[model samples]
Target: AQSVAQPEDQVNVAEGNPLTVKCTYSVSGNPYLFWYVQYPNRGLQFLLKYITGDNLVKGSYGFEAEFNKSQTSFHLKKPSALVSDSALYFCAVRDSRRSNDYKLSFGAGTTVTVRA
Candidate 1:
């Protein structure tokens, strides 16, 4: 089994500033980590994923995450913030080894507010 945690309920950042949403995970074996964003009243969208290879993975909209195996953390980050970036973000994880069942366990979610 695998689980993910988003420590912050919300994150506030000024436009043009860097923003980071913390995430930590736990699993039995190697883990596959992912980041998703949800706009109000819509479905969740994929951001980036860490399957293997590089520890640093880049995704859409200049967003990136670092896969820290030592700390069991996969934190999302953006070099600069935009007011349009305001939305709900979720961190998810699945075990490297899969069964017949395919499912993803997601974090509680973190609301990001970017102000002008």
Candidate 2:
């Protein structure tokens, strides 16, 4: 089984400041991790993913995350925060070894408030 956790319910950041949303995951086998963002009243959009190789993975909207094997973490980060970046974020995970299972378990969403 795979599971994900987003410990913080909300993250407040000032515009132009760095922004981060924490996520942790666990799986019996190799884990596939993903980050998604949702604007108000909008469906979730894929931001990034970690399938293999490279500890640091970059994604759309100038965001990135580092995969930490020891820590079992994949935290989303942006060098600068924008008011427009305010949104709900989610972390998801799947067990890669379960080829027959495509189910993804998700963490409780984190709301990011980037203030101007």
Candidate 3:
């Protein structure tokens, strides 16, 4: 079974500073990694993904992630943190092993709090 792990329960950052939210996963075959952010009481918004190609991938809201195949990690990073960027972030992996590959196994989630 494909699974994702978000080791951090929360991440705090000062406004204008760089921020990173870590994510790791276990999957059979080539993995499809995805990052999504959710504001308070809102739906999850897609951030970025790593399907193939370059190890470095860029996404929405000035966010980018580095895909490390050897380490099985796809860490999300922002050059500068913003108060508006504060939200609940999730790391997900598609379950390619199953017939219904649409299912996504998500991590526990990490809350990002940005302060001015």
Candidate 4:
């Protein structure tokens, strides 16, 4: 079974400051990682993903994530955070071992608060 974990339940950051949301994963085979953001009463918006390319992947709204195989981590980062960036973040993973398993297992989620 594959699983994802967001270490912090809530991340507080100041506007214009760098923002980070940590994530770790466990999978039997190669991992396909992804990051998503959800605003109030809205569905999850795709932020970024890590498949079989570069370790560093860039996504929407100035967000990026680094996939570290050694550490089994995919941490999301934004150089400068905006108040509008405050939302719930989720880390997800899909195991490649199971070709038929396209389903993604997601973390509990982390709430990010950006204060101006």
Candidate 5:
């Protein structure tokens, strides 16, 4: 089965410091990985994705992720954390070979707290 796992329940970091949220996946075929962030009372916003190209992919808010095929991991990274960045993060995956009925499997979610 295709799924994503986020080992951490929460991540705490001081403002202006680098932050990372780890994620790993299991899929039958090639995977389309994605990172999403959600604030209070709002839907998730797309951060980045690893489709078919380079390993390192950049996304909104100066965030980036590195796709490690060997490790089956895609970890989200940011050079500097902001208080506003405090939110819920989710890692998701979709099997490219699957049909449209295949929905994205998401992690339970990690809460990022950027302390000022």
Candidate 6:
């Protein structure tokens, strides 16, 4: 079964410092990885995705992620964190084994707190 695991329930980082949210996945074939951010009651907003090619992919809000095929991991990163960047994050994966459907399996969710 394809699944994603976010080991951290929350991440605390100081403003202007780098931040990272860990994510690992298990799948049968090449997985379509994505990172999404949710604020309050709003729906999740796409951050970035790793389909093919480049290992390092950049996305909205100056966020980036590195796809490590060897480790089966896709970790989100930001150079300088901001208080506004504080929100709930979810890591998702679309399993290739299931061709008929495009259901995204998401992590439980992780909250990022940026301290001023």
Clash count per candidate: 0, 0, 0, 0, 0, 0
Residue lDDT tens for model 2, 1-116: 68999999999999999999999999998889999999988999999999999999999999999999999999999999999999999999999998986898999999999999
Q: Which pairs of residues collide in model 3? A: none
The TM-scores of all predictions, comma-separated, are 0.97, 0.98, 0.95, 0.98, 0.97, 0.98
The C-alpha stretches of model 3 lying farther than 4 A from their native spots are 97-99
Question: Which residues of candidate 2, in runs, are more than 4 Å off?
Answer: none
lDDT of each: 0.96, 0.95, 0.93, 0.96, 0.97, 0.96
Extract clashing residue pairs from model 1: none
Which run of 10 residues does model 6 get worst, by summed lDDT?
94-103
Instruction: After superposing candidate 5 on the true structure, give the runs of residues whose Cα lies further than 4 Å from its correct spot.
Output: none
Cα lDDT tens digits for candidate 4, 1-116 = 99999999999999999999999999999999999999999999999899998999999999999999999999999999999999999999999998875899999999999999
For residues 1-116, write the lDDT of model 1, one tens digit per residue: 68999999999999999999999999998998999999999999999999999999999999999999999999999999999999999999998777666688999999999999
TM-score of 4: 0.98
lDDT for residue 51 in candidate 4, whole number 0-100: 93
Per-residue lDDT over 1-116 for candidate 3, one digit per residue giving the tens place of the 0 to 100 score: 78999999999999999999999999987788999999999999999998889999999999999999899999999999999999999999985556654888999999999999
